[model samples]
Target: MFSEQFNVRFYETDALAHVSNTVVAGWFESGREPIFKLFSPNLDLRNWPLILASYKIDFHLQIFYGKPVEVRTYVSRIGNSSFETYQEIWQQNQKVASGNTTLVRFDFSSNKAVPIEAEIKSQLQEHFYPQQESAK
Candidate 1:
């Protein structure tokens, strides 16, 4: 799993004094930088190879300012042309939120999804997470 810490800024809070829901999304995206680097080592936007397919966040507790938030990201699943990242935000030793994001490897020139190459897939496996099996 990849972990990143960030200081909560006052502006990121809402009138209720909790971090805004929208802000958590940005944090999760930032936490994916490591995975992004695997796809684009130099992070060249002009030749970006991945596209965000979808994301979902579930809040467990209110996140407030004055504390650092740690985002833990894991490669939950890797498919032929896409991967899913499971992330969690923790503050003051408590989990504040958890999320999942799906990103597709794309060939922008052809506007189509491309299979993930073996070399890169091997790298991604280093941070893989064992997802729980569904109940019968």
Candidate 2:
């Protein structure tokens, strides 16, 4: 798994003083940066190869501002033309939220999904979710 820590900014909080639900999505995407670099070295939007198919988030606890949060990311599934990312947000050593996102390799010109390259698939395998940890 790959992870990153982020210091919560004041503006990210909601009226209730917890990090806004909408902000979690952005944080999850930030955790995916390492994986994104595998597909797009410079992260150029013009030639972006992946497209989001769907995503789901579950909150386990509230995430307050003024503290740092860590996002852990793992590749849960990899298919011929798509892959799924599983991520979790932790604060104060407790899991606050988790999410999963499905993204497909696409051919923008044709507006169709395409098979991922063999080398890329091999690289993705290196980031698979550990079976033992999944039990937690």
Candidate 3:
């Protein structure tokens, strides 16, 4: 799993003095940056974008400003032209929210879904779960 740590800012807090629900989405997006960088060191996402197909978020606890947060992300499933990722946000060592996102592999030139390349899959696998020999 890939993870990132960040501090909740005052601006991210709502009238309740807790992090806003929308801010959790932004935190999830921030966690995706390193995962995408692993696929291509110099990837220009604007050129070859992975479009979001669907997503779900479950909020468990309230997050407050000045608290340190950690977001963990991992690929849970990979399909022919799409992949699903699971993300969790933690504050004070407790789960604050969890989310899942489905992204479609697209052909920028054609502007449509396309099969994921083998090389790309291999790269993602290496970063998310490196292969290990079975114990005998």
Best by lDDT: 2
Ranking by lDDT: 2, 1, 3
Q: Give the 10-residue window scoring lowest on summed lDDT in candidate 1.
A: 127-136
Clashing pairs in 2: none
Per-residue lDDT tens digits for candidate 3, residues 1-136, read 7889998889999999999999988889888877666545677866755778998999999999997999988777778888877889999989989998888887778988988888877766654422221221
Q: Please, what is the whole-model Cα lDDT of each candidate in the order they appear? A: 0.94, 0.94, 0.81
Q: Model 2: per-residue lDDT, tens digit, 17-119?
A: 8999999999999999999999999999999999999999999999999999999999989999999999999999999999999999999999999999999
TM-score of each: 0.95, 0.95, 0.87
Q: What pairs collide in candidate 1?
A: none
* Candidate 1 Cα deviation (angstroms), residue 15: 0.3
Superposition error at 121 for model 2 (Å):
0.7
What is candidate 1's lDDT per residue for 1-136, written digit by digit as tens? 8999999999999999999999999999999999999999999999999999999999999999989999999988889999999999999999999999999999999999999999999998888875522221
